[model samples]
Target: MSIATLSATPPPPSSRAARRTGRLFALTGAFVGVVYGYDTGSISGALVFLSRDFHLTEVEKGLVNSILVCGSIVGALIGGKLADALGRKAAMLIVAGSYAVFVALSALAPNVVVLDLVRFLLGVAIGISIVAAPLYVAESTPARIRGASVAAYQVATVAGIVITYFVNWGLSGGGHWRWMLGLSALPAALVLIPLLRLPDTPRWYVLKGRTERAVEVMAMTDPDVDPRAEVAAVSAALAEESGGSARSLLRKPYARAAFFVVGLGFFCQITGINAVTYYSPQIFEEMGFTGDGQNFLLPSFVQLASLAATVLAILVIDRLGRRVVLLCGIGTMVMMLAVLTAVFGTGELSGATTWIGFGAILLFTAAFNFGFGSLIWVYASEAFPAQLRSTGASVMLTADLVANLLIAQFFPSLMAWAGAARTFAGLAALALAALVFASATAPETKGRQLEEIQGYWRNGGRWPVAPEPREVSPGPLSPTGPAGCAERGA
Candidate 1:
């Protein structure tokens, strides 16, 4: 059906079947987050045992940890093209399989070199999953709950981390780092099983010119949605695509969106969240919580706080809006970091001061999880049009990987050279900058449909002017006259 014809017909009412289908896809997609969390969290605890077993130097230890991020950088660089060419579901399946293989290999590594190489390969899978899972969730779900659905991935990620902490604690006594690392393979296998049954998203089908199948999938996911109307909207959007290359993102309007996505990513990582996540036990040790028992117990508390905060973000992100949560979260993080800097800088690493530092770490984790940690992927997944969503997310995630690599790789040296206080002060400064950038430019995408969000960017970051009843222009890509807005809705 033509865009004009489809737009004139009102959307069908939503049905329980459709909502169930959407929820299923969302939950399945979140398994990718579990794989990610397990891999990341498992490493932090494993590092201690791995270091003892392998006799790893400080620099070598960092490499073992940072190499995965390095591999993820390459993975993200190519993830956009892979997702676009292979389709999101196919790409994610590949990611899950790769994770299964490499994580198992990481457990068997005879030396640090083999471990680093295997971890990097696993990272590539992580990079692809990061881009594909959220893209699929954003496209399959309805706009009203899009933010919460996408944030579900983050919730699952934190959940995975929390689970790993307990696993690490259980295994820490025996120094069974191999078992800790190998356990990640279980989640990767779990993620793969569900993906085997899932379908490629409707938007993807439309992009491939399979309008009938697109409609069928949409019907299954949202019984109330008018499939034909949605297909027309998809068709119109695809027709407007200049190309899907990275170069295309450098063009007008898209360039701005790319910058915004990248900035969001940079801010998310620069705040030192990964440093804390990857090395929380080490940090606790530095703060006078030495010995095996204290190290295992204290860091778990930090992760628990993160897990709770992520749940809070998922509940309230759509209601309070992205900008508000992000700004507030980052601002709170800055205060916590400043307090940490003061505590660490004064060389008061004993008694009440150490306890205060522990509290500050928990608070920092809470704030970061509530804001940027949850919103970064949600925002990236929704910011661009369907044609560019994969690439846009990859670009944004690549920026995150870069920040993670640098921070993870250099955190120890930074702490050693500059001291923990100075290191924290530096992060606090970066958080302040993120707060400013988000305040001035963050878009409110709480309730808008994905296409409406595109229209907002197309109209230069403001809402598109109300659709006027002008004559429909020639060609499929031309404006759909007054009914154009009807497709996207109020």
Candidate 2:
């Protein structure tokens, strides 16, 4: 594919009305992200206060933190199917409301048991948001700008983490962990307000056999433009298709694609991003940052770094392409992990070495955002044939949430036994494996149309049909060909 072909699909043009409405979609998605970030990061600060208030042991505190991850496993496994079946808009509204209600209840809980249950329920809501918001955005966005659009989810997530850190810092000082937990509800409530006006995915409308409705929805997403081209594209892809069934994902045509997406999901969580994103402050303190205030201040920068890296990714991804970015990022992560291992293992680690370790952490975050963080969702959505896209996404998210559960449940213990430095090293090794797999097998999709990417790996990674011509055509071959073609008549 030529660069021009990949760059041609511009974001949907908007009328003043549609432009206003688009903000509502963005705000609602951001609210969902805020809730996700809060649930994941809130425990980092509150763990100390909660331990004191409840007289909790270290193991129990870890378990409390792990409960949500466990619940996320089940929630992620089923959330996609539920969205596809019940409708993305309906599922999000229900989840947004329930997420708020249950999380607020957790804030009021008197004991660890109640708190654990609340965390578990909150995880389910988060799991739902993870799948729903991206799917909604992907279905809504035009192919040209889809990468930037869905990346808005990660931006919201990072923002949520930063805000929660500040909130926890301010509130936890006054024995206000309950308020810390309860304040999460504010964003959840706000998300629902705009969700009431948000349109359903045009793809979902196609699935439901609502052709006219689908076109109507598509038009609203880009009111200044005609929907005919977009509608016809989806319709042609879905021709002879019923609404995609879950079982279809396991069939021969889709099974490999399904596995690829699921593996992508698994690799995403296994990179130990959550271990850092959720627990970085705790990890920093353990690494011997004695001052509480400094530890808190440092992680906010990490969040900032993550957001900046993702923005960079959006700019370069279509240009550099996916495989190159994933390999380069993961390779750098391994090097950083190796440095972290040496730094922490030496009892002499202090001053300069500590600063180096800190720098390594920042580098790792930047690398992850550039690759796994950005590409996983993009690849998962585009990898499958249209008939199985939703099912493949559902399966992919299940693997991700499952890995999330394992890491959340055991990472503290792993740190306890293996130490944070070594644990990071292990994650780095896993990242290396993902890099190898990606390099050896993943196809380049930089300039290909989303619908065309399904066949990317076939024909030895060349399009069977010659890609859009990159050079101007020579005049029809003369009997003796052109002078340049004859090399100046040699």
Candidate 3:
């Protein structure tokens, strides 16, 4: 297949089968999100009880949270390579099984050291899942609905968070944090059964030179399309990719895309979303919501708001495009954070001021979920060529995990040292940076075919340059001046 033979348009799918396959993949892949959400959310409520049981100091408590993040960083670093080597389905299966085992182990931990080790191991699964699940969805699904399909994973994540909050609320009375952490393992086990049966993506098969298998999966995934054509197109695109290496990503077009993705990943965490999610109870307590019911209820409301906004993103992402939604969401977050900073910075918290802070935090939650939260995975999944997609997504996810680790370790102390207002204000500054970055560098990948998107960066980070102009002989309307110069009608 030649460059000229490459089609900018994605091959059309049999509507019914495509929809079926897409929905199935989206739902099953979302188990990754479920594990992530439960892991991240369960700790917030569990930490309170864990602290009491272990007589933990503040720094020790922070370690319990930060160790998972450090594990996630390690996971993200290795996950891409694992996915590429083992295939996406296998990687996800490994992640699910790990989640099941490690989460259960976490519940049984006798000391903070053991708990930290288990949680960190779980984080590695999380890091691998985040990369593999989205990569599978991106590679398997049709381009037309890719954004929403990928965003569905996030919806599952938010749903998992919401479910954990309710679990936290229900169990808070008994101080049964063990049960709270143990509950996540059940879902992890359930998701694994389906993942075990799922097929590796057609693209991955093609990458492995198994064209017959690729065609078979493609037919099942999109029955109306000519499997041969689809396979050939993917093969042609793969042929153009340089030998897959971390070094290749550092050069030219991949480097440019990497910068944008890594920046987004950093900003996503530094903007304080995770800090708020992980420490919502702490934040609420500081806001004068000391009652047990108030402590659990408020964070539920925040997660609910986040879940709703993620649904909204799913509806409009492909239509509104990635850049528009990202800028709007980040801009909204910055504004809400500004409100929070102003309310908290001035003085003591009154009832009215507390309500204002609550409102601002909820709005910020909605805005972050509506924009960057949903789109970051979508963007990372599609930005690189198929050959490097998994590795590329891993790189970006690793950046996100790195940011998460920093925020997790220091956010509490930062809040203590700087005060809530200044801490939020600092996040607002990061949000502002995110908004600017999205506006200037984020690619508009709303409806483009993956190959078409790869083509954008194939020529060393710029669109292919047009050919040089050729000289034209003087025409009837032309006026000749010096030597051989010719002027046209103009």
Candidate 4:
């Protein structure tokens, strides 16, 4: 295949079809984000009320939060195979439905055991969403704006987190934890509505040997382009990587990539992002932000800041590129966490100190948004060979949830036992290490197609410079191919 053959024969630029296709793909992230945010954010306020109503001890309260993460670990492990078997769109819709049903059922739980079980089920949906949705977006989108389109997922997540705060604050006044928990179902339900209109991933269709359907889906997802070459490319990549066994992750070349991705996922959470995001108000109260109840406002700002950072990342991801942005973001987070540790180490620092501490937190949120939050899932989905993409996503995200579970379960107790200064400072050290790891190991993925990335990983940092557009041949007809695939334009 030659470059000319893979060149997108887009409909007239004057046509509106491409824009519509782009919008649809972008919204997939938005829907996914809302659901993710609601599930996570709703828990805090609900847990507060439940602890009061059910007289939960500190350990029990932690259990309520940690149980979901446990379920997520299980879901992420299996999610890849499900995506491979069911097709990305179908898998996502099924997860959404499962999330809705379980969340609603949680509202009716009569005891802690039942509540924990229901919450665990909800976690499965969350885990599945983390893997399948991103894979779908990566496979469905063209490369040029791939960062921005898929970024909608992160943006949506931040939005979901912020909106749930508003929902929790509104319902908290009435002491309706059930309403807070139940409110999550709305986003899940809404996601399902639009999902009915979405097309399956072209890669998945091709893997199933439905090239004609893959072409049609490409047209619907990017109508301005003739998808024949892209379809052919996807078909070839699927053929080369057809055995979707989870154990294959430990085999040659893939083994190293899997290690890094799983490390990245686990480290992303161990930074204590979820700890604060999940329990911000409690932390603020400990800092002495008293009963003005302005604590609710903290997470909203964090979410908004995160959203802004994600937008910035989208613009520069293909420009300044992934490794640089991650360095900057994680480095900033380390510095902010240091300041946080210093402030909290002083023991009962309140008022201005508390506000400064919060300022430091906002910076951390910005850093995460720009760096790990945006890149983690994107890289996880794209960094692997086609055969291992889904399974790799599953393994990495499962590791992520395990870290999430640990932090969510023991963080409050750790704060009490270790003191705020030591706890945050420890997290700061982890962030520093993450920054170093990213600089030493992460590759520049800007403008490279997914196929180009495969060679980048396979060569272990000695990968060749990408071919100039004019000199490039179309090469193979896989998703990772030099031409005819999403990476060609990326």
The digit string of per-residue lDDT tens for model 2 on 142-184 reads 5544555667777878778878777776775476878878888
Pick out the ten consecutive residues of candidate 4 with the lowest summed lDDT.
6-15
- 1 versus 2: better lDDT goes to: 1
lDDT of every model, 2 decimals: 0.82, 0.74, 0.81, 0.78
Task: Indicate the worst ten consecutive residues by lDDT in candidate 1.
Answer: 2-11
Q: List, residue by residue over 95-185, the lDDT tens digit for candidate 3.
A: 9899889999999999999999998898888877766777888788766667667767778889899988888888888888999899988
For each candidate, give its TM-score against the true structure. 0.84, 0.84, 0.85, 0.85
Superposed Cα deviation of residue 286, candidate 1 (Å) = 0.3
Runs of candidate 3 exceeding 4 Å displacement: 1-22, 142-146, 253-256, 378-391, 443-490
What is the total number of backbone clashes in candidate 2?
A: 0
Winning candidate number (lDDT): 1
Clashing pairs in 2: none
Lowest summed lDDT across 10 adjacent residues in model 2 is found at: 1-10
